[model samples]
Structures are given as structure tokens and as C-alpha cells.
Target: MKLLFVADPLASFKIAKDTTFAMMREAQQRGHALAVCTPQGLSWQQGLRVQARVQDIALTGQADDWFSAQPERLAALADFDAVLMRKDPPFDSEYFYATHLLEQAEREGARVFNRPRALRDHPEKLAVMEFPQLIGPTLVTRSSADIRAFHAQHQDIILKPLDGMGGMGIFRVKADGLNLGSIIETLNRDGAQSVMVQKFLPEIAQGDKRVLIIGGQAVPYCLARIPQGNEVRGNLAAGGLGVAQPLSARDQEIANAIGPVLQQRGLLLAGVDVIGGCVTEINVTSPTCFQEITQQTGCNVASLFADALEAAVRGA
Candidate 1:
């Protein structure tokens, strides 16, 4: 299979931990041809199909200089057997526009994992609202009064922006509501943006678990990212310690309930964030932790992903 990964620059990847790098390595080992491009390389004109300026690459199996690339060339997205969208996000305007371009590529017979439309529909933070039964008390609003009221009810709450990734702009307000008004201003931009507020889950001390679902099935193990000292965010990017462990009963339950639905919506892969058994985020743009889970649990998450991707491409 000829796979084109629409991702960040190869130079930016920490191959040891990057999920996209893991997938590329697995695919390369399996003899699948590999190419890569950033979303910035995506282009479409009135008469031409959606195309990307892609560079064909070969993994060198070395630590420092891991990949060798040929000169870049423009190719229609449909020319590849599969196009993996592995871009990280704040889901800003450019990201939103990129999805539309990918959706156009889909119409032109491109096979895109975690379908472009699905990515647009499932904003990580907002996607959890679809399954209220699986999540804790959560509120989405731009109004300061509504946030204040929710804080009054929950006493301890977490405030975050809808488009934030890697635990950015997240804040916790206790019963005393320290900096509550300031946080609201920062997160909501004074009614210019919406904020997601959820009741604080103390089980976060146990870790924020990332349960990966591939091909509508739950991976047996999850990466529990435990918050370091004085940190409320348990994101690996936020200095959390990642511990791979078997999924708990509640974790499986949540995965079971959400996986099929997400798959049906065209999400070939998803990372469901569970804190204290409550679904907090449904990461579709680029769900990760493949290396962490695989290293500790010997689960080979990238192989599972390769299996699913091969099946998808063949079936497509």
C-alpha cells in the first residue's frame, strides 16, 4: 500500500513516542510505501483535484537521523492507497480549512482515516457531550453567569477552551472560586468563545487514561498519564508520567459504548480520555499513545492500527 501521512514535519517528531512515527515504522516494516506532508502542503485549485506536496520517505531504523526523503512532488490525495491525518491540533482556522480540503479529497476517491467530516464534527472537548451517560457533569457555555452557576453547583470544576489540545488553557476552580472570573475571561474571551466546564474528577490522581479504539474495537491496554507534582493536567505533553496498564472494567465499558458509535461516524481511530471512569474527551484528529501502550504492555498498538488500516483500505 502507498500511504501518505498528512502530519507535522518529520523533523518535529520524537520518534520514540510519536504515534504517527510508530504507525509509519510499522507500515514501513510491512513493506507499505510511505510518504509524508504537512497540512500546509495541501492545495486545491478550481480545476484540479485536492493535492499535497508530498515527499516519499524511507525509515532508516536509526536514532538521530531516522528517515530519508526524496524530493517532494505534488500528488493528488486520491493517488495514495491511504492518507493518514496525523496533525496535532488547537483545531484553529487552518485545521478547520484543511478538513474541508480532505473531505474534498474523499469525494475524489481518497481513503482518509478518521474521515475528514468526522474530524470536523468531533471537536475533542465537545464530542463527549454526545454520551452524557458516559461522562460526568459537564457544561459548555460562553456566558460568565452560566459558568458561575455551574461552579456554584459543582463547587470544584475544570474550565477549558473547546479547541485546546495537550491540556492547554485548562484551569481548576475550587469552592472558593479563586480566579474564577479571570479564568472565564481567559477561556471564553469575554463571550467571544465557548468554554467547557466539568465537575472535577478526583480520580485524576489515579491518572487520566487514554483508551484507544481502532476499527471500532478497544485496545486491551490504556496509557494512564499521571499528573506530576502541582500539576492538574495529566497530559504527557504537560509533563505527566505515562504508565501503560490493562483497562479497568469501567474503561472497557466506556470504550464499548463509544467505540462503535464513533466508528459508524467514520472515525477509524479514536482516543477516548477517561478520568475516574468518566469520558472527558473523544480525540479524533490524532489519537496517540501507541508507543507508550505497546512498550509497557507489549500490545503492539501500531500493529493493531496497521491491521485495521489494511483492512479498511482493502475494504474501501
Candidate 2:
């Protein structure tokens, strides 16, 4: 199978920690052809969707690990059996446009994971607010008054931008904390966009467990993002340490409940974050943590992903 990871630049990839790289390595070990590109590299040409500067891949954990595919423009996207929309997100307008383009690939009968339509429609926070019992006390609003009211009621609340990822625009508000007004200002842009406010779960001080679900079942390994001192956001990219941890029954239940719907939507891979067993985010765009999980368990989860991908390809 020829797979393309529409993600960040290869030169900038930290192979040791990149989940995309881990999957690419697995694809190669299983004798699948793999390539990569960013959204900008994607274009529609003469009724054919294509990418620029794609190359074949090679995997080596040793010093020689490198990409061997020469820098050639890619074949038509539909030429490949599958495409992984592995781009990280703020789910900005441009990313939406990319998903729109991938929708065309679906029309052309190519398999696109986290199905383009599903990816486009699902906003990380709002998607799971449907399950209030599994989520913390949550509210999404653009009104500064409501935000303040929630903070007042909870005494401490976590404010997250509706469309942000990698922990960007996530702020902690205290009952008497400073800068509440400015935080509200940042969240409200003339009331066009709404921010998500949830009761601050004290278990966040312990960690936010990132559970990876492939084909809608909980994988054995999960990475607990333990927040550093004085930090409220437990994001590994935000200086949180990635420690291996066991999933609580609630975590597994959350995964099981969410998985089938995700699979039916063509989301082959997903990472949902649970802090204090409260579902915080459903990461469908480019859910990561494979490298961290593999390192701690000495398990090649990438192989499991490969197994799933092969099944998808065969079914496709």
C-alpha cells in the first residue's frame, strides 16, 4: 500500500517522539510504501488531486534512519490506496478547506482516515459535550457574563478555545485569580467565537491520561501527561511529562462508548484525553502519543496500527 501522511515538514520531525514517524516506520517494516506532505503540498491538477515533493520512506532506529524517496512530485492522490490526514490542528479555516479537498478523494474512492466529512464536522470539545455525564461540568459560550458566572460557581474553571489544539489558548481561571477580564477578552472576539469552560478537575494535578483508540477499542498503553509545577494544562507539548499509566475502568468505558462511532465515521485512529476521568478532548485530526506509549511499554503499537491499516486497505 502507498500511504501519504499529510503532516509537517520531514526535516523538522523529531523521529524519537513523532507518532506519524512511528506509523511510517511500521508501514515500511510491513512492506508498505509510505510518503508525506503538508497541506500546502496538496493541490488539484487537471481533475486529478496530487501532492508535491513526496518521497518513499525508510526506517532505522539506528543512526542511519533516513528517508530514501527522492524529492519527486507525487502521483495523483487517488493513485495511493490510503492517505492519513495527520496534520496537527488549531482546526483553522485552512484545515477545513483541506478536509474539503480530501472529501473529493473520498468521492474518487480513495480511503481517507478520520473520514473527511467526520473530521470536518467534529469540533474537539463540542463533539463530546453530547455526553455530559462523561464530561465535566461544561459550557460553551461567547458571552463574558456566562464565563464569569461559571467561574464564580465552580471557583476554578478551565477555559479552552473551541478550535485550538496542542494546548494553545487554554487558560486556568481562579475565583480570585488575576486577569479574568483579559482572559475573557481573548476568548471573545466581538462574540463571534465561543470558548469552552469546564470545572477544573483537581485530578489534573495528577495527570491527563491520553488514551489511544484504534478501530474503536482501547489500546493497552496510555500516556499520562503529568503537569509540571505551577502549570494547569497537562499537555506534553507544554512541558508535561509523559508517564505510562493503567487505564481506569471509566477510561475503558469512555473508549468503548466513543470507539464504535469513531470507527463508523472512518476514524481509524484517535486519541482522547481524560483528566480525572472526564473527557476533555477528542483528538481526531492528528492524535499523537505513539512514541511515548511505545517507549514505556516496549510494545510496537505501530504494528497494531499497521494491522488495522492493512485491514482498512483490504476492505477499501
Candidate 3:
């Protein structure tokens, strides 16, 4: 199989921890051809099938210099056996436009994992709304008054932008409401944009668990990203300590309820974030922790992902 991974630059990847790299490595080891491109390489001109400037590459099995690549060439997205959308998010306009192009490729018979339309539909921060029973008290609004009211009710609430990633722009307001007004202004851009506010989960002290769902089934282990020092965010990118552990009963319950539904929506892989057994986010774009969990638990996550991807491609 010829696989095209649409993702960030190879130079930017920390191979030891990059989930996309882990997937690529597994596929390559299984004798699949590999190619890659960034979202910026995608283009659709009048009458041409949606295409990308992709580089066909092979993994070198080395630490510093990992891949050897051929020069970039134009290829229709449908030319590959599978197109993996591994691009990370801000989900800005460029990323949004890239999905439309990928969707066009799908019409041209390209098999894209986590279908482009599904990615557009499930904004990581907003996707949890679909499973209210799995989440805690949450609110999304642009009005400061509404946020203040929520804060008043919850006493301790977390405020973050609707499009934030990697724990950026996240704030916590205590019962005293220190800097509540300023946080609301910053997060909502003075009511020009909406924000997501949720009751601060004290279980955050334990860790924020990332439960991976592949092919509508839960991975047996999850990476619990525990906050370090004074940080409130338990994102690995935010310097959290990642501890791989077996999924708790609550984790399994949440995964069982949500995984199949997301898979039906064309999400081949998803990372569901849970704090205190309450769903916090549904990460559809470029979910990580594959290497961490695999190294720690010996679960072979990338291999499992390869199995699912191969099955999906065959079915397609």
C-alpha cells in the first residue's frame, strides 16, 4: 500500500514521541510505501483532481536523520491507497480550506481517514457537546455576563478559547473571581468570539487521561498526562508528565459510548480527553501519545493503528 500522510514538516517531528511518525514507521516496517506533505502543499485548480505536492520517502531507522526522500512531485490524492490527515491544529482558515480540498479528493475516490467532513464537523473543543452525559458542567458563550454567571455557579471554572490547542489561552477563575473579566475579554476577544467554560475538574491533580479509540474500539491503555508544578493544563506540550496506565472502568465506559459513534462518522482514530471521568475534549486532528503508551505499556499502538488502517483501505 502507498500511504500519503498529510502533516507538519518532517523536521518539526520529535520522532521519539510523534504519533504520526510512529504510524509511518509501523506502516513502513510492514512493507507499505510512504509519502508525506503538509496542508500547504494541497491545491485544487479548475478541472484537476485535488492534488498535493508530496514526497515519497523511506524511513532510515536512525535517530537524528530518520527519512530519505525523493524530490517533491504532484500527485492526485486518490492515487494513494490511503491518505492520512495528520495535520495539527489551530484549525485556522488554511486548515479549514485544506479539508475542503481533501473532501474534493474523496469525491475523486481518495480514501481519507477521519474523513475531511468529519474533521470539519468535530472541532476538538466543541465535539464534547455531543456527549453531555460523559462531560461535566460546561458552557460555550461570547457574552461576559454569561461567563460570569457560570463562574458564579461553578465557583471554580476553566476558561479557554473555542479553538485553543496544547493548553494555550486556558485560565482558571476561583470563587473570588480573580481576573475573571480580563480572562473573559482575552478568551472571547471582547465578545467577538465565543469561549468554552467548564467546571474545573479537581481530578486534574490525578491526571488528564487520553483514551485512544481506533476502528471504534478503545485501546487497552491510556496516557495519563499529569500536570507538573503549578500548571493547570495536563497536556504533554504543556510539560505534563505522561504516565501510561490501563484504562479505568470509567475510561472504558466513556470509550464504549463514544468510540463507535465517532467511527461511524468516519473518524478512524480519535483521542478522547477525560478528567475525573468527564469528557473534556474529543481530539480528531492529529491525536498523539502513541509512542508513550506503547513504550510504557508494550501495547503496540502503532501496530494496532496499522491493522485498522489496512482493514479500512481494504474495505474501501
The TM-score values for the models, in the order shown, are 0.98, 0.95, 0.99
For candidate 2, report its TM-score: 0.95
lDDT of 1 by residue, 45-97 (tens): 99999999999999999999999999999999999999999999878899999
lDDT of 2 at 178: 74
Off by over 4 Å in 3: none
Worst 10-residue stretch by lDDT in candidate 1?
160-169
Error of 1 at 124 (Å): 0.5
User: How would you encode candidate 2's per-residue C-alpha lDDT over 67-181 as one tens digit per residue?
Assistant: 6656667566677888889888878889998998888877877688878898977788788876677898998999988988888899988888887777888998777957888
RMSD of 2: 1.7
- Enumerate residue pairs that collide in model 2: 56-69
Q: Using alpha carbons, what is the TM-score of model 1?
A: 0.98
Better of 1 and 3 by lDDT: 3
Candidate 3 — worst ten consecutive residues by lDDT sum? 182-191
Model 3: per-residue Cα lDDT over 18-102, one tens digit each: 9999999999899999999999999998989999999999999999989999999999999999999999988999999989999
Deviation of model 3 at 160, angstroms: 0.5
Q: Please, what is the whole-model Cα lDDT of each candidate in the order they appear?
A: 0.94, 0.83, 0.95
